[model samples]
Target: MPKLNLSQSPAVRAKWEENLKLDSQEKVTSSQQQLPNSAALTPQCIEKRWQVIAERTNKAALLDTDSEKQQNLYSSNIEHFIGTVKLPVGLAGPLLVNGAHAKGEYLVPLATTEAALVASYSRGAKLITEAGGVTALVINEGVTRTPVFEFANVTKAGEFVAWAVTEYEQFKQLAHSTTRYGKLKDININVEGNRVYLVFEYLTGDASGQNMVTFATNTIYQYIIQSCPVDIHSCYLDGNLSGDKKPNSHTMRSVRGKKVVADITIPAALIEKRLHTQVAKMVEFGQMTTTGSLLSGGIGVNAHYANALAALYIACGQDPACVAESSIGITRMEQNAQGDLYASVTLPNLMVGTVGGGTHLPSQKACLDILGLYGSGNARALAEVTAGLCLAGELSIVGAFCAGHFSRAHQRLARR
Candidate 1:
């Protein structure tokens, strides 16, 4: 990519500007699914459709490129279940979020004013037309696996890791019920600061398996100590201090050492340096009251809309705790023809459960009830909301920065 100055020609800038347009004209283009963005909900529309759900459960529509195809969009191996919820307020969106587990297009609840933020970002997307798109680099991403306890302090964290990896089958054999958890995949054990954190990955057969993972780990604790040289007396008594929860209730929420980074790539051709600068801002905001630290700015930005979408996540039964890590990631967009960059946003820590926490919360449950996306294994759907939000952040920031009217929209939105 040569650094050619784009200031000389109006034609070139216009071409790039057009490329920067972040138009989701699909709703505008297609005839069948078209409904007013603000149309009142109908009883006929009330009947839930699609295999996966929008993050904002109130808007339960889905768009599967595969939905147009024959083979099941909802996998045969996977099952659909709902715990159901009710919403006290209206949830609106075009909240965009993407996740490893989520594959297609769907709407999500906009937890904040940023819910429809793509519109604002798209405005930026259009201005950078001379530039083309934005870019993204995953400076960081990874999920948290909490502490493991042992009665006696066993020094060899390596030994446990090696054994877990090498003796995988043996550990698999020790389990009394693969029945409860078919999803258990890898066991990662890390020793940091007089404590070891065990992160066990599983292909949980069905549902958001937080409790299932805890139960399985607890069941396996005895086997680890009895077979390995690690001591077990002190760890046995303090339970939550053991698994992915907390070290000691005293320490509260803090993360140290042993992490996994997941990332997505976005083109830099469209949004240019604005892409990098904006994401850095996101990390600066996005507060986590539980941790007393704002979500790092790298991954995405703080959005009123994203907040609203998260509300649906909390209300609908997702792990409200995970939004900290899951919501941050890179937004990349770039231009194919010129040096002008492109953009897309990445969100990493949007952990939502279709089954636990406040999913049963009345307004929350009804909201999920509207989407028919409640209960177990709906994490994928919720993740999409977070991803969509990051994208909205990118579009909003870039479009606003480029067009010179960015502050106007924000001023109006914030005034009331």
Candidate 2:
């Protein structure tokens, strides 16, 4: 098979070059006034930024009445501090989770404006609870940052890789020196022509660890530049190989933040009575969706993983952007010996944290408290609960589709 190359066409090339020229011109001519900038986490700085926004936009709605509390607590999490945006937090559970870390029923808080979302997840949660709950486990865990070093030629790259392998201990030491919670796990090296990418994987305790791994990688990079026997022409902190905040096949195969799997077996009688569909119909629908997923060239095969993850992450103060990679997973449905339905969801990159980021924020913290998953010892439990939540969402959505009520439910809830 031959790959289609659109850039090879003269017309396409000319259009692309023209677009680039216009973009460059726009960058030079744009007179967008920069907002007030500051590193200081004071109420004055926050007020200044908010004033500028209101003056320019002519909208003076206050974010909150208490500016001091916002400045004190939210400074570390955000910059250009202008109040906060609110989303409706909906409850979707009695989601019974039986897992290595997470146990018991949780009333999962989901923040979303999508009309039928909470209802769908709630319906699935109730069904799962009736079926004796879902089993969830955190199978693997790691956070990675890839640093690329460019040399003059392949030989120099090979020499750098050879020297780099021996410095794993020193690299570990330097990385560990930066953080008490993160530990250097392993370093994998990949060579491409004159460039070598050093993949540093770390075990970050209780946090998503994007910043943790970056700081650790920087420490290692600095040490390498000063101590390496081989010379490097150029280098970058991130080579875009770690699959951070992006959906890729690598994360689908291996783990990134936390790999969690959740499954449940529901009786056929319950499926028919509660879900308004038979086990056979659900399995058939699953097969059709799997084929459709393949045709679309999606990274993982699943139904609406993003819907659940996005809502949960937002409500819990996780980096919502992580959903790009975090939602990539495979969902399977099959029939057991008794013709009961067995459903499972495997999320290989569940980037989540129990502390840090937005977890400490008022509403987010309250949501975490609702699940009893706040503070340090609950990250893995949170991941397990998330997997179980996703399983509930998948079953609900698949059941809705199979029962031919998907559009009707959306119409009833979303439209009216």
Candidate 3:
């Protein structure tokens, strides 16, 4: 590939070229001394410069309404707003969900470039809807932020944990006092050597509560510092115990956002007719996959949960990075007494929100609105819908694999 210099005006280009003449090491040292446009890198100024670069590349006209919308939305959330890269958005659904909060048919907006993904999920949705929709429930809801403290000895740490346990109500009050919408649910203590990790879990209303839990946990930390009997050797806000953005057994066993499960019962005849596979074959494949996952020491055993979660995250304006842990879960199918296949997906750490984060952006809001998941009182509804989508995706992939047409579908849709 050739280098494309889409720098600003002639004067700026001249400066950039002059700097480029130096050796790599010297250029790095010199650039550190003086940044490019040090005083004029405001959000608005940055966007203006990006416009110039776009023009130089003969793509200035591509910077249309989307550029303006994204730039404006990013101003409040980011320090520097350069530009927006467009991801092709596709629609999949009329995914029917008989969920506690989410009910009725929903059109799932998916943002992806993968050719066959939307089709596969839509096929699953069709089967689910035909079978009278997926049943979904939000079993639990909490977002955790852990803080670790190191004491001089294990004894001191134990003592501190005991103290924390005794005064749990006081700490809960302190944590709750920090935020209007965040409520402290519980605090779990883990002691490793002389260090103690306090896993503070909170119910963050209608929002992914990373910031909310952080703010509340800090208040509890302050209370401990002032009132605790033990002397702390070292302390930090996060100790990786919260399982944030990382897949681990800790998060899979506990709750992150809403521990939601979605399931459906498919008659054996329908399974064979629609999926092109018998109920016994589907159950066998599920067991095989589960065993394979277990042999690989996987945290969650499932087929392509991340596929559905990532598409939904991008379309709904969520923290895309959370898909790391959020996608970890189990997909199960069994042959019932009535010769039907009972399929279910349980996502333990499905961290999502109907408000805050990127949900307010124009395109993201539009996608959320497609599922009627915009604004408050719909976080659980969103979780249920997400779980249902995951189940649908699982069925499509597993069915395709079992039917020996996985590659055929991909070659037909993706190769084009």
Candidates in order have lDDT scores of 0.42, 0.91, 0.86
| Candidate 3 TM-score, C-alpha based | 0.88
Q: Give the least accurate 10-residue stretch of model 2, judged by summed lDDT.
A: 58-67
RMSD of each: 23.2, 7.2, 7.5
Preferred candidate (lDDT higher): 2 or 3: 2
Model 3 Cα displacement at 142 (Å)?
1.0
Highest TM-score: which candidate?
2
Model 1 lDDT, residue 120, Cα: 54
Ranking by TM-score: 2, 3, 1
Cα lDDT, model 1, residue 92: 36
Best-to-worst order by lDDT is 2, 3, 1
Superposed model 1: Cα runs more than 4 Å off: 1-91, 94-107, 112-170, 173-182, 191-197, 225-230, 236-309, 338-341, 360-362, 369-372, 375-378, 404-407
Q: What are the per-residue Cα lDDT tens digits for candidate 2 across 156-226?
A: 99999889888899999999999989999988999999999999999999998999999999999998888
- Candidate 2 residue 209 C-alpha distance from true site, Å: 0.8
Backbone clashes, each candidate? 107, 0, 0
> Which parts of model 2 have CA positions greater than 4 angstroms off?
1-32, 55-62, 66-68
Query: Taking the tens digit of each residue's C-alpha lDDT, what string does model 3 give over 1-416?
Result: 23536856888777766666655669677765442363343656765556546535644454566675556666556544555667888888889999999999988999998889999999899899999999999999899988899999999988888888998899888887888888998878889999999988899999988888888888888888888888988898889888898887876677888899889998888888888998898899999988899899888789998998898899899999999999899888999999999999989999899888888988889999888889999899999999999999999999999999899998998877
Instruction: Output the lDDT of residue 308, model 1.
Output: 34
